[model samples]
Target: MPDISHDFVDECFEPSTARAASADRRMHTELAASLHHLAEAVQTTDGKLSDSLGDFASNINAGRFVRPSVFRHYFQLVTSLSSGDIDATKALISKMNATPPRNAHRTITHFGHPDADQISLELISDGMRLAPISDTLAQDFGTLLEAGFDLMQNALPELYGEITAIVHEILLGGAPHGDSVEFDGASHYQFWGLLILNPKHHNTPLEIVEVLAHEASHSLLFGLTVDEPLVLNPNEDLFASPLRQDLRPMDGIYHATYVSARMCWAMETLAASGHLSVTDHETALKAAQADRDNYKKGLSVIDAHGELSATGQRILDKTRAWMNRR
Candidate 1:
C-alpha cells in the first residue's frame, strides 16, 4: 500500500497555536457551566441522578481540590461534552440509554453494536460520518468484543474502565477513504470520545483486544495533552513508522510506540493466563515480540525528535517504565 501519512496529517488539521490557546480557555469555562446545568437539570427531573453522573458532577465541582492530573482527565471529558452540538447531545443521550447499566449484563448494543435499522449516520467532531454496520456484522463484532471484554475484566480491569469511559462509541467502518494503507482502526483528537474500527480486519478476540488497547491509549494521551503538545516540532517531516510501512510524523510514531507497549502488555497477559488454545498462544507470543521490537524502535525515534512538555514527559516515562517491567 502507498504511504498516506502526509495526507492524513493534512486532513486532520488542528487549530493554530494562538487559536487553540484561546479555545482551550473558552472550553474550560463553558465546560464548567455545562456540567452545572446538566447536574441541575437531572436533579430537577429525576429527584436523584445515577452514581456515575453524581461522581461526574462532584469531580468537576471539587476542581483544584483534586489532584491536578485527575482534574485534567475529567476536564477532557467536560470539554468533549461542552463541544457537542444539539444533535450530538441527542445522539449521545440515546447511546447512553443503550449503554448497559453498571454490573449488568452487556448486550450487543452495549459495545456499540446497534441493530442495522437503529444505526444512524452521525457526524463526528472531525466532520467525518461514521459508517453503519449490518445486523449480521454487528452480531459477529459483538461476540468478539464480549470475549475481549471478559479477558480485560479478568486481566486488566483498570485499563478496561478507562477505555470504556473515554470511548463513548465504537463505529464500524471500512478503511479510511483516501488512505492507500488499510487501517484496522483510527481515533481523532477532536473525536476524543469515539473509536472507529474495521471489523473485517480484526476478526479474532485477541486481535480485537490489541486494537482496543492501542486506540484507547491514544484517547488517554489526547486527554492528558489537551492543554499542550506532546512534541515541540512541527509535522513537516515524515519518519518511518515501526508498526507499519508508511511514513508518519513524530507525534504519530510516539502514539504508535506508546500503544505498542500496551499491546505487548495485553498479549503477555493473555499468553500467561493460559486462556488461549495452543495455536492462539503461539500467535500471542509472536505478536508480543513484534510489538516489543516496534515499541523500542518508535521510542528511539521519539527520543531523537520529541520535545515533550512536563505532562508529556511524565506520560512517556510511565510508558517506558511499563515496557521495562519483567
Candidate 2:
C-alpha cells in the first residue's frame, strides 16, 4: 500500500466533506491521487488478479474510513476543468455509454456496497487496469475517457480520426500501435487513458483536445519531461509566459503550451488541406483572433526556438501559412 499523505486530507477535500465522519467511506480519499494509485495498482504483475469489479470494491471498502465530501470535492474540481454552464463533460460521458476497451479483457466492481456509487472499476485481462472514481455513480474516469474518444471519433470522424492517424505517425513513425514506446499522458491511444478535466474550466472538447495534443506533441519532441509540482503562482514571475518563456517551469508545460498550439495548428492545417470546411476553418480563425496573445506567443515560440521537430514544424508552418492565406 502506498503511503497516504496528510496534506491530502487537508488539501484535497472540502471542509464539509472532509470532516464528515459518517460520510461515505469510499468517497473520502483524494480522488486525483487515488486515480494515480489506481493506475499503479492495476499495473502489478501478480497473476492472482485478472480484474474483477467486486474484488476491487471489497478491497477499497476495506480501506474505507474517509468521508463522502471527498467525492463531492472531486466532482467539483473535475466540473471546473472546462469553462461552461452545461455539464458538457458529464454529457459527453453519457453519450458514449462506454463499453470496456476493445483490447481490454475485465469485470466491473463498486467501491462500497453493490448498490453504492461505483467508484473503482477494475479491467482485468492479461494485466489489470483499474479506474478509480467516476464522474457519476455509474462510470469512472476511464469510462468517461473512452466516451470522449468515441464522441470525437464519431462526431468528427473524418477529422479526429485523421488527427489520431497523424499523432500515431509522429509518435510511432508509422509503426504499429503496440510496438511503439509506452504512452503515459493525460489521454493516450495506448493504455486507453484520457484525463477528463472539468467542463466549466475548459468549455469545449476542442479545448481539451488542444491540451491533449500538446502532450502528444511532446512525445515527438523530447521524451516527456519530468513533471513539476503545480505552483499556484507560476505566473508570479514575469518569465512564466507560455510563449518565449520556458514552459518547463510549470507543472504541465506541454499542456500549457505545445499541445494547445498543436491543436490550433492541427485545426488550421486541416483547413489548409481543404479537409475542414471553410466555415469551420473560419471558426478556428475566429478563435485565434479572440486569443491573439496566445496565438502570437505560440508562433513566437516556434520561431524563436527553431526547436520543434519536423512534424512540429509542419504543424507550425501550416498554421502560419493558413493564417497568412486567410
Candidate 3:
C-alpha cells in the first residue's frame, strides 16, 4: 500500500512539471509571436486596437476572421468554432446589449427560412486544415514562381501568369490578412490566399486560369500582400449588397456599379480565353449589364463630386470594355 501511494505521487509530479514546461515553451515562442503579429495586422486593417478584441469578435461571428496563426492553434479554434459570423455577431450583440441575457445556448446560430441554411459556428476547428491541395496545382504555381515573380510584390495579373504566381505564394505562405471572404459565395480574398473559384466546379484548367486571373486582378488593385484599409467601415448590409446606407450616396443611391463592372471584365476575360462556356459568359455578362444603369448613375454622381484617380478610371474602362463586347 505504501509503495503504491508513492508511485502515484511521483507520476503526478513528473507529468505536471513536464506539462507546465511545455505550456511555457509554447507561450514564449509560437503563441506569443503569433498573437502579437495578429494584433499588428488587425491594427493595419482597422487602424486602431482600442476595440480590437471587440472587432475580432465581430469578424469571428461574421466568418470574417482569418489570421493564419489563429488558424494554426487553439487561438483560432476558439474564435472560429465558438462565435457567430457578421449576422450572428450583430444579433448576439444586439441581444446582449438589450439589457438581459437570453435563454439561448452559449453556442448560438441565426435562423432564417426553412429552406435556407442556418449557419453554425460550431466545431469549425475540427475539420479545417491547411495542407497540399494537389501536386499539379503546386507544380503550376512553382513554375510561375520560377519565371521571376512574387505574388506579394506585384500588381494583380492581367493574365494567367500573374495569377499562378499569386497562388503559389498563397500556398507557400497564406493570405495577406483574413482566411476567407463570404460574399454570397465562399471565396478567399487576397485577404488570405490567392484563390479563384474552385477548379472542380468548372472542370477545366483554362477556366481555372481565368478565375485565378480575375481574383488576382483584385489583388493587384487592392494590395499585393495586404488588403487596403476600408474606405468606410463595412457591416452586414454592405456585405449582402454594396447598396447600403453606409455606401457612398451616388445621387442619393448606394450601389455596386464599380464592383459589378470589374467582375464583368474578369469573367469576360475568362470567356474570351474559352475558360468559361458561352452560357456562363452570357450569365455573367447579363449580370454586369444589369449594373450598367447603376454604374452610369454612380459615375455621374462621382464625377460631379468624387475624384477618380488615373488607375481607378483605367479599371472601370477595362471592365466596361469587357462587358460591352459580345
Candidate 4:
C-alpha cells in the first residue's frame, strides 16, 4: 500500500501518470483483498458455485476482471453472493466467465445499452433510467470524443495520460428524449474505471472534453476514497452543488470543487492550444471561466462547512496552492 497520503491528495489536484499508476496498483490490491474475502464467504455456501471461485481468482490475476461490467459483477458477488440464495451467484459467476478480457489498445469509448448479462446501477437517486443512443447519435458522440481526445493529447498530454489511465471505458448513455433530471456524467466507485455520460451535453469536442475531465476527476476521488472519506461531515447535511441542481453532501461538494478545478484546467489548456476553431475557442475560454468561478465557489463552501479530515485539509491546501500558482 502507498504509505504517503499526501501524494495521493496531490494527485487529485494535479494528476501525473506515475501518481495515477500508483493509485491503479493500490486500487487493484484492494480489489484482490475484497475478492479473497468474498471467496471465503462463498466457500461455506454452495460447493459448485464456490468451486468457480478459483477460476475467478485466476481470471482476475490474468486481468480479465478489469472490464467495468465484470468488475461490477465482483461488486454483486461481494454484496449478495453468499448472503442468502445461491442461484443469483451462479448466474453472476457465469456472466463474469462470459465477459471478454479487456482489449489492451482498443479505443476506450462506447455508446448504447450494456449487455443483457450486465448489471446496470439502479438510478433511484437520479429518477432517470439509461436508454440506448441511436446509431446516428452514437456515431456523432464517438467523433466528438475522439476529437476531444486529440485536443487533450496535444494540449495537456500529462493530464490526458492520467485521465486515460484512470478512465478505462467511457459509455455514453442517454435518458429518454425528455424525462426531467439530466446528468452530464457520472462515475461509480464500484465501477471504478467506467464513465457514464449523457450525449446531450456533448455537442462539441470542447464541451465533451470538459465532461471527460469532470467524470475522470470523480474516478480519481473514488480511488482515494476507497478506504475513507475526504471530509468528516455526514452526507445528511446537504449543501448546494456548483454543478448539480440539487443540494449535495459535503463530500459531494468537495468532489465538485476538485472536479471543477480539473475541468477548468482542461478547458484553459485546450483554449490556449491553437487547435480549436474560432467558435470552439471562444466557447472553451468561456467554459473555463465558468469552471474557475465554480471551483472557487465550491472551495469556499468546503472551507466553511466541509469539516474535512487532515488528509482532506492537505488536499484543500494543495488545491488552493495550485490555483494561486503564478
Candidate 5:
C-alpha cells in the first residue's frame, strides 16, 4: 500500500517556485485590470448604482459569474484610487456592506418530518433571493454539509485543517437544474478565499463530502498556483474531462484529476474507518473505486496532451505519485 501520511499530503500540496512566480504575475495583472474597471464604472455613475452596476450584480447572482469577492476588493481599491473623493465608490461600499449576510435566512428545522430531533439549517424566502432552494429543503442540505465536515474532521483531519485555513467563506446558492452540487473557487476567487456552493443536489453526507473535498482542493490549488501557470500549453487545446462529458482545457483536466485523487483519498479514509453505516461504507468504497478509475483516465490525458513547465511537472508528479501509490 502507498504511504498515506499527513507529510505526504503536505508534500503534494506545496506549490513550486515557478508556480508561485507565475501566480504572482497573473495576480498583479488581474488586480490592475480590476482596479481600472472599477474606476471606469465608478466614474460613470459618480459612485451611484448605474445600469452597469445593476447589470453586473444581476449577472453575478444569475450564475456563471466571476468572483463576487472581487467586487468587494475593488471597493477598497477604488476608495484608495479616488483618494476619498469618489462618493459613489463609498456608497457602493456601503451598499455592499448593507447587503444581506450569506446566512441571513438560516433557521432550524427538523431533519425529516414531524418527530425527528435532528435539526438542520433552513433558508426561507430571504434566501430565495440568492438561491431557489426553499427554507425547509435548505435545512436538510445544510445538515448534509455539516455531516460531511464532521466526517472530514474525523477521518481526514489534515484536509480539514487545510480547508479551514484556506477557505474563509462559504457562499450558498442555487445549483442549475440537474446538478446537485456546484463549486466556484477558481483563480478568480483566490483573492477572497471564498467557496460558492449550491447544496440542493446533495442527498447524502457522502455526496456532500465529495463536493466539499473536490471544491476545497481546487481552492487550495488556486492559492498554490496563483503565481504560476499549471501548464505552459495554450488553453486552446481541449481534452476530455473524466468528471464531465464536455471537453475541457488541460488546466481543467489537471484540476479534475487532482481533485479526483483527493476525493478517492477521502472516500478510502471513510471506507476504512468502519465508522459509517453499512450502506454508507459500501457507497464510499464504490465511490473511491470509481474516483480511482477517473484519476487514471485523467492521468492519461495529462501525459498525452499536457505541456507542464518544471514547476507544473513537479506538482503533477506529486499528484501522480499519490494516485499510483497503491
Candidate 6:
C-alpha cells in the first residue's frame, strides 16, 4: 500500500477478491500511521493519556481496527489531537468503545435501521431532507439484501466476497428518495464501512440489487482512497454527474462511471442466472441495459474531461475493458 508501486490498486481494478481483501487489510496501516502522529503529540502533555492510548493502540488487532465504529473513533481522535484539546482528547479516549466491533467481516449478514445512537453525529449536520423509511420498507430490505447477495454469490462470487471484505454494515436511513444527490444510497468518507441507503427509492428487488452494487462499489472506492485520491483534480473541479442532476467533482464523475458498470454486472448476472421469477428476470435485463446505457453516458464524459491519476487511469482502463468485453 505504501507507494503502491506494486500496483496493489489492481486488487480493485482487475477484480481479484483475494487482492481486494488484502487491500482492505493493508488499509489498517493508515490507523497505525494516524496513531504514530497522535502518540507523538500526546507523549509530553500527559503520561497517563499516552500510556492509555499506547495500550489501546497496541491492542488494536487486524480484526478490531476494521470496525466502522473504530474508524469513526480514529477520525475523532485525529480531530482532538489536531486541536491540541487535551480535555476533549481525554473525554474522547474515556468514551472509546473497546467492545468487539459490530462490523462483522462479511456482506449482507446484517441489515439495520439503526437508532440515533448508531448513527454518525455528522448526520444531523448534513441538513438533508430525510425521513425514516416505513416499517414495510425496513422489513423488505432484509429480504432484498438476502436475495440480492445470494445472486451475487452465485454469479459473481469474487465481487460478493470482495463486498464482505469491503462493507461491514448495511444501514437504511435518510431517504431523500430520488429527489437529489443521495437519492438511492450513499457511502460517506467519514463513516467508511457504512452504506446509508434510501429504502423508498428502490421500488423493486432488481432496483435493490443495483443499489447494493452501486453503493458498495462506492464504499470500495472510499477504501481505495484511504491513502490517496482516485483522481488528481480538486473537489472544486465540477463536472456533469451521470447519476445526479447537479455538477459534481471529477472524483464523483469518475466513480459514477465505474460503478455504473458494476451495477450492470450485478443485474446482468442475476438476469442470466435463471434464479429470478419471470417478472424479475425481465426487470433485471432492463436494469442491466439501463446501467450499460448510463455507463456509456458517463464514459463519454470521462473521455471528454477526466483528469485522472495513475491509479484512476488503471481503474478506468479495467472498467473500459470489462464493459467492452460484455
Top candidate by TM-score? 4
28-96, model 1: which lDDT tens digit per residue?
334445555765655654443323445444443444121112222344444544674434444443444
Q: In terms of TM-score, how similar is model 3 to the real structure?
A: 0.33
Best by lDDT: 4
TM-score of decoy 2:
0.34
Clashing pairs in 1: none
The C-alpha stretches of model 4 lying farther than 4 A from their native spots are 1-12, 44-51, 62-65, 106-128, 277-279
Q: Order the candidates by TM-score, highest first.
A: 4, 6, 5, 1, 2, 3
lDDT tens per residue, model 4, 76-128: 77656647756777787788778776556424443444442133434323343
**Residue 73 shift from truth in candidate 1, angstroms:** 20
True lDDT of residue 87, candidate 5: 60
- 1-326, model 5: which lDDT tens digit per residue? 12322233335543223333333334334554554466466555454434444444443434322333443545454665467555655555455544433322222222233221111112221132233445566566667778877887787667676665555445555544564445332223423445555665567777777777788777666655544678877888899999877889998898888888888988888788866899999999999999999999999999998988665687777877777677
List TM-scores for all candidates, in order.
Answer: 0.63, 0.34, 0.33, 0.87, 0.64, 0.86
Per-residue lDDT tens digits of candidate 2, residues 200-235? 223334444444444444432221111221133343
Judged by TM-score relative to the true structure, which candidate is superior, 2 or 4?
A: 4
Worst 10 residues of 3 by lDDT: 113-122
Which ranges of candidate 6 are over 4 A from the true structure?
1-6, 11-15, 103-121, 127-129, 134-137, 174-182
What's the C-alpha lDDT at position 39 in model 5?
43
Candidate 6 TM-score versus the reference: 0.86
Model 1, C-alpha of 155: deviation from truth (Å)? 2.8
Off by over 4 Å in 5: 1-10, 13-72, 75-131, 176-191
Taken over the whole model, the C-alpha lDDT of each candidate is 0.60, 0.35, 0.34, 0.74, 0.59, 0.69
Model 5 scores worst on lDDT over the 10 consecutive residues at 116-125
TM-score of 1: 0.63
